[model samples]
Target chain A: MRFTIQRDQLMNSVQDVMKAISSRTTIPILTGMKVEATEYGVKLTGSDSDVTIESFIPVEEDGIVLVENIEPGSIVLQAKYFPDIVKKLPQQTVEIEVDDHFNVNIRSGSAEFHLNGQDAEEYPHLPQIQTNQSFEVPIDLLKDLIRQTVFAVSTSETRPILTGVNMKVESDDLYFIATDSHRLASRKIPMGGNVQPLSFENVVIPGKSLTELNKILDDSQETIEISVTENQILFRTKHLYFLSRLLDGNYPETSRLIPDEVKTTVYIDTKELLQSIDRASLLAKENRNSVVKLTTKENNRVEITSNSPEVGNVVEEVTAESLEGEDLKISFSAKYMMDALKVVDCEKVNIQFTGAMRPFLIRPNENDQILQLILPVRTY
Target chain B: MRFTIQRDQLMNSVQDVMKAISSRTTIPILTGMKVEATEYGVKLTGSDSDVTIESFIPVEEDGIVLVENIEPGSIVLQAKYFPDIVKKLPQQTVEIEVDDHFNVNIRSGSAEFHLNGQDAEEYPHLPQIQTNQSFEVPIDLLKDLIRQTVFAVSTSETRPILTGVNMKVESDDLYFIATDSHRLASRKIPMGGNVQPLSFENVVIPGKSLTELNKILDDSQETIEISVTENQILFRTKHLYFLSRLLDGNYPETSRLIPDEVKTTVYIDTKELLQSIDRASLLAKENRNSVVKLTTKENNRVEITSNSPEVGNVVEEVTAESLEGEDLKISFSAKYMMDALKVVDCEKVNIQFTGAMRPFLIRPNENDQILQLILPVRTY
Candidate 1:
């Protein structure tokens, strides 16, 4: 493989592909990144079993040449130092050549590096998802969907199925939900498309995969085509391809976890409540779960407090916009509450509580598309 | 104890004192910070046996009331959560009150915290340094002096003395030197005024202590008074007192390690040389010390090359301002060379090499105050 490429373009592609590369892969060849030079452009691929990322640089685009002098071939170079070497090369352009013996030579300015590369044939191939079940979503909306629900996924290994976000589509509506038994996050978006009778469910994506994919994606107006099969899903953009394996199990039904009746409802400024709980959690962090209590007070006021036997106790009074129904007191993980509040991104939030023990729901006062539910801790 | 202090001022003092507080201290009281409110101001102190840092906030400094309502008393609170609480307080002013039973109440805005406190009488007292050997040095200059030589201190605990920097003053010259048996960095500054007949050669300060002190000292033109005694050295600023125990044992003689005779001389841009070696060391980092070989090429060019059997080889040619004497080849740790180059804040640096196996010296072309010496590694 012989190709001369612009250093900045190559660096960007390398970084994008590197998001899927992990050093702990059991397959030795998977530790390397496969580089192929074709008549069209240069393609770089990095994978670690669960997720595979491929980035392509076009030979010429929009009156600019990103890659040139292509002699079609392929070689796999160790991903360990390849990215750093390409980033630190002291020239605007870099030339990479691989001989028949897989000896890779990279030259830029007055620096030349000769690395031992393995034949690209040894690298595992990414499974092809040839299903016609595909849909398009705006990149920014997709990122927001991932961010809103992914954090609620279970991090514990006891329940492997809860470690992924369940994505479901029904006709013209898309829904995403993640719950770790104690807390749940759900989001739904209307997909106005030509579909009249199309529905697919049970597509669970690993939270880690979504996190990495979210980081690799730029906030743009471009639409990403998502194709899903029984065991795999592919996210395809203009010059990038991201593939992640689907979890092989049924996702639990979480709709029943969110309480229906609102025995008590409170409206408060999001920032004020967030800051009050944040201060109360400072002492609460002395405990394991960082538990903090919220109690309704007189005159449309709420008290957020936390106590630790060895540390101390903190109480913060935050004035609420309005409080209705019977007065309520509840205790929950401060971390969970903070995480839920961060994604609301609104001036005011409405919190509904069925009782102190039942799970409560919080949503942006302006929109009901995003909802967060947290199960209160019993602190009698 | 009772006092209301400005949050920003209290936060700054808490951070300064936190530098000396370590959770691993054997003494239980050392894990707490002692706060004493006097008629004048509030003083905060934290210690971990080896080092103690104290910061004072005057009741009224320059007509600005930093602290008010100060009732003379003292108490020790756990340092683990105190700093975080102070930083996240929900008001500009904070009120701290300690009851008769040693329960501390910290109130700000509508938030209140009740913490368990220990009697201040149990806190370790900072030793008094009543020596007449005291001198003043500009804070910026002192920070610079510490940074120029501290990185060369030996991290290995086998030679405890090498883990500290040797500080010597003679007549009107002050010198600082540190070495780890392989590389050495030395800096000297001429002291003007009242130092015509004073000398102290046995003072050694631990590198770790200097690093912490350097972090706490702001880059200002104000002078700091440093006093030395038999066992401890005290650094006193207008509002802070930092005391560190001196490292015992005689420091190794490192003056002879730097070669006086120069058989080869090369002058090059510091940045160019640093970037070239940084690129060459990409593959070299896979090895132990990230060793890179530098050889003088024809036409005043220096070739930096590093090789790893599994990773490959990199060679970079950097043009030098001038190369004199016979052509030479030397191998040294790229890390050591980078550390030395980072401290030389000059465009041009002169490197002096005596032989392939002898130690070499590097210095800025314009100044002789700071010098770095590195020993060559035998590759054969």
Candidate 2:
């Protein structure tokens, strides 16, 4: 492979692809990034077993020419050093040439680095799926959905399916749900779409892969096309392609875990409630699992308290904007609540609970589409 | 202590004293901050066995009145949580009242925190030294001297005294020297002293303690007093007193370590040299010691090269502004060169050496008083 490309453009594409490369991959070739020069542009691919990220540098962008070459070929270079050298190159354009034995020469200005590149043939082939099941959604909305639910996925390997985010689409609405058996988060968006009316279920993409893809996607209003096949799913944008393998098993039906009826509800200003929980967690954090107790009084005031035998206790009263139903008390992990509240960017939030011991739900005071459920602690 | 102090003032002093406290101290009490209220003001102290820092919140400063109290007492509180709580408190002036049993009530605005405090008497007292030998130096100069020499101090515990900065005061000059056996840095200041002045020999102070003190001291033109006793050294500013126990044992003779001979000499821009070394280190960092080679060609150019047998090699040339003496080649740790260059705040630096194998010296082209020495590696 031989080509000279703009330093900045190459660096940007390299970094995007690097997000999918894992240093701990057992297959050494998977740790390297594959670079291919085409007639149209230069493409860089970085992949582990679960996710693959491919970024393209167009032949010319705005007036800056990215690549100029007569030969088209491919080679794999170490992702760790490739990005660093490209970033630190002393010139506007970088020249890359690979010899017969895969010895790659990268030259810019007075600096030249020769990195031993691996044979592109040694790289495992990315799965090419032909089953045509595809849909489109706004990149910002996709990122928001991933951020709202991905953290709730279980990281444990015992039940591997729980480590992925479940996506369900029915006619005009798409739902994203993730649960770790301790907490559950679900978000639904009314994105009207149809190539053919689809009701696809049991689609689980690894939470870790989605997070990396989310970071690579620009939060613009640009649309992202997502295609799902029998084994692999692809999320493609204008200049990037992200592919993630599907989880083999069905995701647990989490609708039953969220309470259908509420015995008590309280509306609180999110920032004030977040601060109070933070302070209460200070003392509660002394324990292994930081848990804080919340009690709603008859006068719409909620008292937050946490205690540690060595560090004493902290109590704070935050007056809720509104409260109804039977006055109730509940205890839960402060970290889970804080994480849930942080993702829901709203002025006020309402928390609904069936009882002190059951899984309670927190959502925007006025919007009910985004739901977060947390199991209460048996702190009697 | 029963008093109300401004939140900002208390937070600043707490942060300053906390610098001296370490969470891993074997003596648990050293992790606590001692707070004492006197008729004049409140004093906060934190100490490890090696260094102690006491900050005084005066009764009044300029337009800000900090303390209001008639009763006097003292107590010790855990350094970890107190700073966080004080920073997060909701009011301008915080009221702190200590009960007979040392339970403390800290109230600010509508927020109240009750912390279990330890008896101040149990906290170790600051060292009392009859420091008749005292001199004053500018705070900016002291901070400058500390920064220039501290980075070269030995971190290994094999030779305890090499971990300290050696200070020697002659009739008109004060010198600071530090070395880790591989590299040495020395800085000198010409501060005129008394005619019947006390000639002081080399006294070593732990580099770690000086680093903490340097972080706390502001680079103002204010004069700070330095008083050295047999086993302790005190740096007293207007509202702060820094006490550090002298490292026991005789500091090695570092004067002989600095070579006066000359051979190959080169002048280079300090910033350019630093950036080049940073880039060179990236290639060498895969090796155990990260050694980079430098060779001055007869054609007035410097060649920088580093190679790993398995990872290939890199060679780059930089044109020297000026070069003299026999054409030379040397290899040294990139980290040592980077450290030495960081302390030399000059536009251009002149490097002098006896031969390729001997210890080389680097000094500012504008000022030769401050010198840095780096030991070369034997590259096979």
Candidate 3:
């Protein structure tokens, strides 16, 4: 392949695909990125066994000359060293040429590098998914859903299916739920589109892949189209495509896990509660094995306290806007409570509970669609 | 004991002394900080047996009201938890009170903490150094000297003396040197006296203590006094007093290791050479062991190359400003060279050598007192 392209354009394409390049050297060729030139533009691909990313850069955009080529071919170059070199090149335009034997040469300014390239024929191919089973969602909403629920997924190896986020789609709404058996988080958003009549439920997507996809996705409001097959799932944008394998096991039914009614409801400013939890955590560290206690009396004031025999005790009286129902006292992991509160981007939050041992839900007062749940620790 | 202090002032003092606090719980009391309320002010002390730091906060500074007291006494509290609590307190001033049984109560707004405090009498006392053998030095100059020579100290415990920086003083000059078996660094500066005459020959200060001392010293031109004793050395400023034990052994004579004659010399831009060294290291990384080769010709161009059977080879030409004496080629650790160059605050440096097998020196053109020596690796 012989081509000349803008240095920044090539760097951006390399950065996107480089995330999939394997650092393990068992298969040396997998550490390389494949570059192919056709009549339309240049395409780059990188993959490990579990995930693959492919990005395409067109020859021209508006009046800007992005890529100029005289021949069309393909070659594989080391991804680890290629990006650093391209970023530090002295010239604005970079020239890449490959010989028939796949030896690649890159030149910019007075500096040149000769890298031993592998044959592109040895590269793995990407899986194809049927477009009929695909659905579209706004990128902002998708990233928000992932950030809210992915952290609650089980990281331990007890139950393999629990390590993934349950993604369910029905008619016009998408619901995401993740739980580690100890605590859970759930979020739902309404996205109207052409409905696929088949109901899809309990589809497990690994939390690892969802987190990585969230990081690489930019803050653009453009829609991302996703297609799912029996074994693989694909995310497609205008210029990029990402694919990952689906989990093999069945996800647990969490529909009955959420409590039906709340015994006590309290409305507190999110910032005030978060700060108090952080302070209460100082004493709670000694009890990394225990939970922080929260007490609400007949009035609107709530007291947060943590006690450890060796470190003494801390108490903070935080005034809430209002408190109702029978007076209640409960204890829960300070870390879990902090995690649930941070995802709530609102001024006020409503915390609802059924009992000391039952799961409690926290929701943004303004946006009630998103909910966070925590299992309270039973202490005598 | 009872006192009220500004949160920020208490936090700063706690953080500074915490550097000397022991993280290892061998002796439980060593992990805590002692706070004493005196007629003049309040003092905080933290010690780990190797080093001790005592910081004093007067009754009033610039009308900051750092401390106000109703009674005088002392107590020791766990250093790890006190700082975190004070930093998160909601009020501007924190009120602290000690009961008859030694239990302490800290209060700010609606937040209160009851800590288990240890008796102050159980804490180790700070050492007192006589001022008969003391001298004054600028804070910036002392920190610079430590940065220049400390990295070359031997990390192995086999040679305990070599793990410290050797300080020697004459009638009008001060010298500092450090060496591992493989490399050495030396710096010298002329001294003037508004002080007493000092003719100390050899005092070795532990490299680990110097590292911590340098971190706490600000880049100010104010003078601080350093006093030495048979087993300890003390650095005292207006508000802080630091004491460290001297390494127990005689330092090796390092003057014989420096070469007296120059065979070949070359001048290279500091930043230009550093970047090239970083690039050449990429190919070197793939070898059985990464090693880079350098060759200097009479034509003022230096060549850098590295090769691995599995990764191929890379070579680049870097143009030097000038060359003198015999043509030369030498190879050393890229890491050592990078470390040496990073501390040099000069634009152009002159690299001098006696022979290919002997240790070579890197020194700036304008100032020739400080020199960095690196031993060439025998790559058979």
List model 2 lDDT by residue over B122-151, tens digit each. Answer: 887667768568888889999999999999
Can you write out model 2's per-residue Cα lDDT over A77-143, one digit (the tens) per residue?
A: 9887888888877779889999999998888776678888999999999887565678888899999
Task: Report the lDDT tens digits of candidate 1 across residue range B60-164.
Answer: 888899999889999999999899999988899999999998999999999999999999999877787787778888999899899999999999999999999
Candidate lDDT values, in order: 0.92, 0.85, 0.83
- Relative to the true structure, candidate 1 reaches a TM of 0.98
Interface RMSD for all numbered candidates: 0.8, 1.5, 2.4
* Residue-wise C-alpha lDDT for candidate 3, range B292-337, written one tens digit per residue: 6678865798776665555555566778888788877777777677
DockQ of 2: 0.60
Best first by lDDT, ranked? 1, 2, 3
Best by the lDDT measure: 1
Q: Which candidate is the best by DockQ?
A: 1
lDDT of 3 at A172: 68
DockQ of 3: 0.49
Give one digit per residue, the lDDT tens place, for model 3 in A292-357.
899996569999998877888889999999888878889999989999999988899999989788
Q: Could you report the Cα RMSD, in angstroms, for every candidate shown? A: 1.3, 1.9, 2.6
